[model samples]
Target: MFKGALDNIPDRVKVFLLSLTIMFCMISTVYANFYIGIDKVYTHIFYVPIILAGIWYRRKAIYVALGLGLFYIVACTVHDSIIDPDTILRFLIFLVVAGVVGSLSRARERFHSKELQAERAFRRVAKDLQLVLESTDEGIYTTDIEGRCTLINVAGARMLGYGTEEIPGRKMHQLIHHTRANGTPCPAEECCVSRSRITGVGCRISDDIFWRKDGTAFPVEYSSYPIISDEAVIGSVVAFRDITKRKQADEVRSRLAAIVESTDDAIIGTTLDGIVTTWNAGAERIYGYTAKEIIGRHISLTAPPDVKDEIAGILGRIRSGGRFEHYETVRRKKDGALINVSLTISPIVNNAGDITGASAIARDITENKRVERELQEAKAQAEMYNDLLSHDINNINQIGTGYLELALSAPNLDRGVRELLDRSLEALQNSSRLIHNVRKMQEMKATAGKLAPVDICPLLDEIRAEYSGARNGEVRIDLACGNHTRAMANDLLKEVFSNIVGNAIKHSAGPVHVGIASEEISLNNKTYCKVSVEDNGPGIPDDLKPKLFSRFQRGNTKASGRGLGLYLVKNLVEGYGGRVSVEDRVAGDPSKGSRFVIMLPASA
Candidate 1:
């Protein structure tokens, strides 16, 4: 009851009470000194108020000591007492006690004030720590060295499938971690939290399992941190989180890696600078280099010297995030043999979507390339044989024609023999035409080069003069062309016109009238030169016209020569980036003869 009353007293009231006590003590001392003839005995009572004031008021204790000393001096003088050495000594003692006690009290008050501030700071920190523990998703709890749960946050209680009323004061390991993941015994002594308390060090376990209140277990990644006080291990804090998703992701990656290892194609990984970083078993079988032998080596080790630039180009593209599919190239094997390979390369990206390296799958295409080359060689050989046979047959036909001409020119030759020789000569001419066409077809297949500008007007005139002179007065040839009629064509342009015009004259029954005209035309926004060759012969039937440009196809049975003339003309014209077609000279009249139209790109 006294302690409670002291705590309730205000500072001013306490000071008033102390002053009243000091005044009472001073009066009693004066009464005892003067009336009772006692000096030191009653003066000792003054020490009580002085010491109480020092303890209560700190520096203000000096005023009480000084007040009591002045009263004693005034009382001594009033009582007819002379000031003696003892009195002076007693006055000095009052001042000394006030100074000493006041100074000590001030120091103690300063110390007490600092301690109060420190206590307030500690309270704020504790509040903040509690807020953090309750807010986080991770399970957090503390346990004593004996494995008893001292405190558990809301998250910890929920994570262990327990309520707030049920979690605390229970044995922690027995409540949530009594058994291992595989249903084996896990006592409290062997628990990670207990071990941390004993060892005074933190413990972390990634692949461990923690049981819930329902007797079910889940994979967990957890850390146990020992809480120390006064250099002694007191308890431990365990922070844990579920890791089921992480384990699932690791399993998926393992399966994908297994598939890559089992594939037959060579799978390799290289850094952006072309240094080999990964090589699978397929790479060892295909390139004859194991991962131990080739990893960290430059990718150029497998590339032929001639294809080094090719490898560099591939790396450059991959670095720019470009992917290549089925890129066929050549590489060198371990045995110094060159092999063809088809490569599919893609960039390897990191989590930040930055290109770090490249992955490539290479397939051996050597056998495919070998078969292609063999087929090409066989085709070339067949063409060579065809060219030789055509040349030989043309020579024989020319010899037979020459003999027939000589025999027909005899002065006394019989009419019947002349008629028979003329028929044989015509047959020989037909055979010669077939041979010539075959040779031209072969030349067209083998020729390579771009077409040049050829003046259409002059080429047409030359053909007209030659054909007219050959027929003497039997045919009439007319040419109509502008001065600057030029087309993108080569020397074969003349042969194209020769076949068209010659066919017109040969297929005509009476005097043939062949007219050639050239003009500029626009097709598909591009300029081209259109040349037309018209004759007054039997026009092609609608049904046969479609096949007129086909090899060995004749428009009519009455036609006199091999039917390769129009076919050769179309192939040669189109080879110069031109188009050729035949139409009736007069639209709807089959008897008006045919007109062959040729279109070639106009030279700028």
Candidate 2:
């Protein structure tokens, strides 16, 4: 093959044939008329191809061309006379041409070969670039300023669910329509691609949904770079990627966030540096700070001053990818009120299982604190009253029983003795009634358990029977309770009625009337039952009514038993998911006496 390439050269070498023709013509002209100067036109024919071939071909080809020129000179010289001036000049010129062409041709050949190699290298690079662009998984498409598709890689075509025939000349907008996920058109009027095409380079539109040829929607992220030539935007190149999975994950995250914000518990998130990143609606209501005010602030701002070290430790643990559970602490609200909150904090992590930040959920226990304080105070008072009742009632019973024993043992007892015995019996019964009242107050102090709905009527009847057994002839007990009476705790209901009836008998100079009523009311998105116990006795003093339910407090000093009778009544009434307050029966009826109202939760 190599020999064939050279064999195809013309039969006569260009240099030899030209040189021979020139020498023959020169010799003939010299002989024919002894002409003085020659035009030397044929000399040029010999020199030009030799120089060109030397610049274009390799060293060997250049030497062959020179040899042909030498052969022509030798042949022409043999036929002509020796030592002639014209012949000498022709030979000299031929020698000069041969030397210049041979030397320069070799150098030129090397330079020209190097240049050709560079061109080939550039072509290879271009081919490689095409392969890379075509093979990438991400879709690549370039467009012109007129919104026409200028180029689409194989990946781009496949991404739009199209073949090559459908893509090359198609307009970009026609092949793939742009719209919001909600189906709103994202046309030229609102498209960043269109806007950037008219304005400048490096503009982008994110979170857009592209409808493919198959009529299926997919999320896309695209960046457009305007191609400028001579200070004008000739076209744009868009690099796009499918982000359907990313968008779906974002939607799921948004839904879960909404659920957390809707809950009653406070939910919040912080960065690795303990900076608050997110705050929910429940946090707003509990902490008294709006999301706008709290986001991006340090989480330490919500922590109590004393708990800063504690919070720092917790954050350190979270940064180390540890979870902190049920850490009870006091958090300060925007209003400067200290809140008792139960906190659960955990490390928020990425797919690689690296700690990104921390998230916390807090539950408010302010009302629970208030109830605990009230309970403690009620307990202290009950113990004091119980001690007093045990002492006073026992003393009273001992004296009355001692007098009765003396009368029974005396054989010849006088009328005076009988009268004294009757008086003693009456005093003993009064002591028994006071002791019964003390027992009811003790029962009230018992902690309430899980509540179950109970009818109040039967509970009150029992109180009536217990009180009737102990009452002296001076007092009459009556039971007039509404049939609809219902409440949560049976023990609380009994305590309430017992305290009220006992109070009436202790303070009243004569007959005491007890009346119980119930009704329904709406509160906190639920219905509740309100039960009121009214008594016809000397009304509670205005100054004492406010603290009527306070510990170690008594309505009347002369009344038997400890002061906790009323306080216990109040606590028991409120403890069983109810509230109690004392008011006059008839606004102005101080004479008509005191009425205690109680509110209880009812079944949904």
**Candidate 2, residues 505-572: lDDT per residue as tens digits?**
77776666666666777788866777677777888878888887788677764554446667767777
- Off by more than 4 A, model 1: 1-278, 281-384, 407-423, 469-474, 542-547, 560-563, 587-591
Q: State the lDDT of candidate 1 residue by residue for 1-604, as single tens digits.
A: 6533553688888878887888788668667766788644346777777776776776788888888877767766666457666666777788778778778877876877888889888998999999999999888888877877888888878877888678878888777788887788998777778889999989888888888888888888899999999999888889998788899999999997998899988999999999999999988888898899999999999999988988889999998889999999998988888889999999999999999999999998898899999999998898788878777878889899999999899898888888899899999988987777777776776664557889999899899889984566889899989667899877777889999898888788878899999999788999999999999998788888888999878768465676788888888887888889989999989789999999998999
* Weakest 10 consecutive residues of candidate 2 by summed lDDT: 33-42
For candidate 1, report its TM-score.
0.56
Taking the candidates one at a time, how many backbone clashes does each contain? Answer: 0, 0
- C-alpha root-mean-square deviation, each candidate: 9.6, 17.2
Regions more than 4 Å wrong, model 2: 1-81, 96-115, 143-150, 178-203, 226-235, 256-263, 270-281, 288-320, 329-338, 350-357, 369-604
C-alpha lDDT score of every prediction, in listed order: 0.84, 0.72
- Span of 10 residues, lowest total lDDT, candidate 1: 1-10
